[model samples]
Target: MIDQYYNHSTVYQRRTQDFAKSRRISPASTRLYTGASMEPYDEELFREHDVKRGLRNADGSGVVAGLTRISDVHGYRKEDGKFIPDEGKLTICGYDIADLIDNAHAEDRFGYEELAYLLLTGALPRYDELESIGARIGGLRLLEDEYISEFPITTKSKSIMNVLQRAVLLLYAFDETPDDTSAPHEIDVALSLLARLPRIAAIAHITHEAETSGVRVVVPAPNASSSMAEAILEVLRGGPDFTHEEAMLLDVMLMLHAEHGGGNNSTFACRVLSSSATDAYSAYAAAIGSLKGPRHGGANSQVTRMHADIREHVEHWDDDDEVAAYLAKILRREAFDGSGLIYGMGHAIYTLSDPRAQICKRYARSLAQTKGKGEEFALIERIERLAPEVMRDVRGTTKPICANIDLYTGFIYNILGVPETLYTPLFAVARMAGWAAHRMEELYGAHRIIRPAYNSVMDDVTYVPIADRH
Candidate 1:
């Protein structure tokens, strides 16, 4: 493993290995390079601006300001309790998210292949460009050079996020030219990965199913003819009847979540790592680790767990008052171990009900109606309609109380036969486009090492020797 790290990986611990032996040949240790180093800039300037309060305007506090936008494509502005991402800027790469939604409900839906081109290249593709991308992506799905199948594929009580994190490293291993960080090369790596990651995620699930069901699952490579949803359908619920509407619906989900700017925890991980001029593989692998945190990409699964906890207390969901009581009691910590939290009720960013959540909620209704899951839809619908009031009245929560994107996506994902464990892996699949674009932007546009300083808590300290301590 250490040899692998030394030879292949750009990890910190291994970078310093064989330090004494390598010093003679190292170009970085030369006197000329050392003498030419730039002067240290003032760290206080960042502290004066209060930049490191988690990038907030003050020490862990601020109203919304200064969030960066890479794609003005999905522009949103909150006004009077609603998100009005106007019809035009919502047009990503000349195609509207709304039109895709309309198409999903009506005819065959466009796959993420089209959106990948838009986000990575920053322009809408013609038919020829789209076809070329689709072909290229389909061809890149197999992990032939660095096959993950050789690794121990266990899934019993194991986190799928961890599995995905490992698989990203596998992608890094697959790249023959891992250290090529030039803009053109990195873009190709990112694009190749955009097409490959969904299949990687699907393989993790397939392995899990194989372990649990005691059946051999022959995971298929990505096919250009199949939409991502159709591929997932065949993997999870196998048959020839992978419907266009369902595949398109999932396409919409991926497109909607594709990008939300670089401030998000995972995308920010991408920015920071790539700022060091690290390879695209390491950058995205770092991002996968960040997304594994329960706070970032785990909310959709939390929404499912919250539903389970709610069911343990409130059996009857038809009564609006009863549902409200359950929500209030949970927020007040009278139920669910008196945990003073409702998992899917609010967001860190969006002040209004999340626009993505709103879109997903509408789609959830359609799925519920179509699949005769009206009861399931009604329960979350009551929570959606009432949770804000409960938060305001019971917990004295001043911050906005609204359904985040996680709230509604679970129901729709459940309809699509996805389990809770796979929820965040799917998130990685969707956010890959955004992560790739942000990392490349950091590399090409504003190329600075993303080193932030921490304010020292203990300004003065005395060291005690071991013998003198007692």
Candidate 2:
């Protein structure tokens, strides 16, 4: 065990390069951060062995515990972007994401409501069951006046995620059964947050927008008949009207973002917190804080800014050579901040393409065509077409750097008139459903605290007197 070697007599190597070579690991690829850089990010690239084992079972025996897979939560799985195992389809809770999307597009109901049900329960629902769940969640959306009055609307101080986090923490004031962890109580909390956070998020969006634009803003009465998407849109519009097709598209997007299995940072945070027997609000709030990080949820806004920069630099929107050259320059530090990083082009998961990204790209393309604004969309397409090979050549990253869901989401938000600030907040709004589900699963099944131990690298540490310290 690496922990066993931590002592004064343990022959510690001074340099990471020498240590890597001695351990037969790649000096360039081997990464071990001291102090605070290591933030629970266990990547497959960092695995010491080919196969994974439990912490006590693994002894840094080259097992490469690079975090290939962990957690028992089931999501749509595919091999090489094809679901060859189960008749070439992706299934989450026995419901194919593709089929769910297709069925939602075909159905009159808001697909997201059904998706939330599927995630909360382990099975897909019949029409009546789905409708019943929808009405149940809808009725749970009401908030007391004092609760509504205390909510934060505009903030240059706190982050959107923090606002959501504090909002959940504040729910403790209204919560009479804070000590309750029963399934029925948890489900009630989950459904209430699912229905209510959106309204609060929508108000936050309008307040922020109006604050920025110097316009006095007020939220109108919510429509009881409106679907989730329609309700969120109505709050934004300050009325009870929105186009049906647009709401459908928004519903699909929200469904797609609802859950990505339990391994994701935010969802994992929810499970871990729930394992500590914390209330659902605390667990869900931890997830919001996790999603607030740029590496996780904020990538969407970064992509938006990246697109703006690319448009300013590229002289010809259609030229392949121009796009390639600009991309190369950006990667090579000859242009654009010299960071040598490409945002929204790579996903840590999925070797070929993220299926959700493909769906989102199609929606973005159709929207562009309908609106007759293809320049930026065309530019995005060009980057997507060329980025895989270009990024591979630029940085020797082991994984395929293809388009991910973040690629088009920011643009889609812009198309829907959502402020850039609300991108991550809205992500939290949608992901709350998944967080609640995970929290419930963790609390109900695990019945243990998720406390993990850390190993220290330093072996020799002697206390010094104040004079020696000086």
Candidate 3:
């Protein structure tokens, strides 16, 4: 069951425990941060500190715990003079004078505040509210059904992600525009899109496969439009043929990838829409565009390509020296960065290691064993060990550039019999939940249009009249 406070102590403890076990670290090794400051990994110590400091929990208890915003209420500031409180909003926009003038170390170049707003607010959607929104949105399941039925017979000319883009644009036509006091009504629209986006995405996949393979793919119409996992499984399995384990794994993946701390394409879309007070459709369109980029949702596809390239040359990589030479050649040529990147290695965030990557690695190992393709598992292991060394020597960097979650997710999905092309759309299916939650938060508050200031890099110049042209 979903909890009342999304970032409650129970939730943090559960996550910390899970992450700790996955990383093979002690429970005490998993540090819970109240604010932006990094602290020692001791839950009890942090809890005690909170209690003594009179920090209130989300439930208004005297003790505040959990990683969400407890520190915001207690009032802490970074060494750079930026305030980090346990309550109220924290703006991270480039346009904010404090962020620009004082917090010069802030890395975000655009829409940082919008990203923070989405992450902070969407972390905890009210349970009752989510249920109501889910119910209303589930009603829009027919749109997906119709779109799948009408999809073109030949999808070779168009990518699955492109089809998804078209489907979203078409679906948006059916959405209603809320009145002046439309935030409340718009909540229903946001919820509906979130609930059904996976179904539409999955259907797009099934239809694309059918068109490409000339095989009939059939899926049951969603009964209640419930969980995104259920909808995707219904489409993927096409009936009650899938085992309980398969369903469970799909659900877990959906939930895990639902949201991180923003800074993604879909979340960016939500922020952009909030800034303009535009409807969810327009906002989502912008998000879809962002997701198409190689640095973002395209990571999984890169993973597959990298795997294929390595497999083609696997016979030559007999030793570490050979691997090093090959990697140096690729790096010197800038092959991955320009010719097309090797997917699933490195990320903009999480310099240490991506938590999601760890989960996907576990999932992929299980899947590899299940499929009896031990070679795939072995390949991943080799890549993990060798890739870092290759990168380090080639780039002359000491830090390890490890494979992120997208790499493992791609391997897992491929082993599970999903087509390679559908990887990014699958990411979209998971992210829609976070997108909806962010939209809900934007509608609920004293809605501000997210407008961030930018540094003027272009030179100031005046245009000459056409009549005086040389």
Candidate 4:
């Protein structure tokens, strides 16, 4: 079946190329096509129409779309039509995220699988239930021999995210009931994906490295580790050389990222697709594509690169004045990608703080010290401290800005020996739980197709025949 699909795709590509060669487009035609594009609308029209651009209210708060029992993200208070920044707090299934992680730490156990179960089921599992879910995930972790060997080798995509998306969409072909929308079946498919995506990402990363270096890469088979964090480290490193502290930190990272409400871009994309009652695979694939955007899941890698540039250009990491000057240059479109924006310095929902960032910083500080990177870590801390002040002086930003989770995620991954290519893919792996939970909610709870209205600004005009045109 895979071979047939590949052959058809090859033929289609050939026909498309042949058709392209048969056409001769003149420069005048190209100019005409470009000129036919729509012009930007006046900003006044948005005020006159009371349009909520980007689904956000005038106060920069997201317009409430729907309700869910999955999780809540709180970062501000509204009183008497005023927005007041507050310390951020995140809860998963009515449990404080800090408490959950702390309890897991006290018990010396990994918590991602437990969090996955809670996100899907909306309740904490018992002792037996936890063990059962872990065993189920372990059982589904290994891909079939053909699936593992054929897809990664044949497909030529260098991006791990693209390969992961392709692998997920293709898994539908192997499902016995790919179109099943039943709750039981959806849960099954979600669990299968949660177990398998890490392995798929690992293989894609290894394959790209091998192709580039011309070194033979030995893909590790799935292991029966006690936790998803351990399994990920083992498979990525091609052996069991990681320590207890590293695995525990990875587990905390996964738990922190597992869910961020249904309103996030990728989860919302999933909900939009699921509202149409599509199959689970299509909804999840769409979510993966959404997450691949730079504004969303790709920000961690950007932050890493931006910091590297800072380390290169800034001579004195300890000198606050020098760091602030470089940051001001970045805001003035003179340095570090010239976008005039810091990558990891702000959050849409959190104003004064992001609880996840706060928690990740604590753990990252310890890891940085252990790995002999305290200087680099302190440099990052200085950037976080100075970026807001620089933004205010240069960009005239009035509202409060805080360091988001991306500020520390890339640093943490580096400490864990993870490649930059896998940063966003690993985000997707943890986010699969959230995506699945929200997809199920949209399918079962919402039950209405999402169709938002768009006000058209173009005036109607009579169509002209080609011969009658100017």
lDDT for position 393 in model 1 = 95
Worst 10 residues of 4 by lDDT: 31-40
lDDT of 3 by residue, 51-155 (tens): 332233432223311122111211132356433322211222112222321232233112122222233343323445445445554576655435545553322
Poorest stretch of ten by lDDT in candidate 2: 60-69
Q: Could you tell me which residue pairs clash in candidate 1?
A: 333-338
Tens digit of per-residue lDDT, candidate 1, span 1-470: 32444344334333344442466536445433333132222445456655545665441223332223355333335578554433223444445665645654564547576677777887767889988887777666656733655443532337777877776676666568889988778878876777667776777777777888999878655466665556556655544456667777788788778876667789888888888998888888889889887677876787788887777778898888899999888887787745567777776555554667778888899899999999878998888888988988986666656677788888888887777778888888888888988888788887588876665433575998989964
User: Which stretches in model 3 have alpha-carbon errors above 4 Å?
Assistant: 1-140, 144-157, 178-183, 213-219, 225-227, 316-319, 334-340, 398-400, 443-446, 457-470
lDDT (tens digit, per residue) of candidate 4 on 265-291: 999999999999999999999999989
Error of 1 at 77 (Å): 7.0
**Model 2 agreement with the true structure over 424-451: per-residue lDDT tens digits:** 9889988887887778878877677877
| Candidate 1 local lDDT, residue 90 | 43
* TM-score-better candidate, 3 vs 4: 4
| Ranking 2 against 4 by TM-score, winner | 4
Which regions of candidate 1 deviate over 4 angstroms?
1-52, 58-69, 72-96, 99-107, 145-157, 238-241, 337-339
- Pairs of residues clashing in candidate 3: 71-85, 71-86, 72-85, 72-86, 72-87, 73-85, 73-86, 73-87, 137-192, 275-450
Local distance difference test values of all predictions, in order? 0.70, 0.73, 0.56, 0.88
